[model samples]
Target: MSTTVWIILAGALVTYLTRIGGDLVLSRFERIHPRVEAALNAVPAAVLTTLVAPVATTGGVAEAASLVVAGVMYLRGGGLMTGFVAGAVVLVALRNLVG
Candidate 1:
């Protein structure tokens, strides 16, 4: 009814169409190439880096320390939840101590 609602619906429709289109095209192939699969697998990490890089760069010491702890946990084979919990703990502790 509203312009904002129309815009949101259009965006959702476009997103759905693109996703379905990609699935349809990929489904025709018997097997995906290793390189293509690797690239697809890397997409999440690339997107995450894009999302976090700016915050990490501009954030304070507490944020930096938390991110470092989270990264260490990940490198040590911790699960995503573990890394997030560890980072949250570090961030809260540091903010309390620093502020």
Candidate 2:
């Protein structure tokens, strides 16, 4: 097989194993410990931060502006859906204005 095909197969194998391993590990714990449960709950915020931090810092004006707006909305007690909608609207308006 070609090197590219081998690489793709390896990646797919690794991805599949990752998903299966996560399920197995979680299933082994019948009752999660408090600290572990809290950490697991924080995973969403951590993932979101990882995903958005780069865009907020180095993205285009519209992206950065929208991230800031969304953050403000979230801090100001807006729910996730509200923050997302407000940020999307800001991004769309900025994109239209700039383009």
Worst 10 residues of 2 by lDDT: 51-60
RMSD of each: 2.3, 2.9
Per-residue lDDT tens digits for candidate 1, residues 3-32, read 999999999999999889978898899999
* TM-score quality measure for candidate 2: 0.68
lDDT of 1 at 76: 91
Which portions of model 1 show Cα errors greater than 4 Å? Answer: none
lDDT of 2 by residue, 26-48 (tens): 89988999999899899888988
Each model's total of backbone clashes? 0, 0
lDDT of 2: 0.90
Q: 51, model 1: CA deviation in Å? A: 2.4
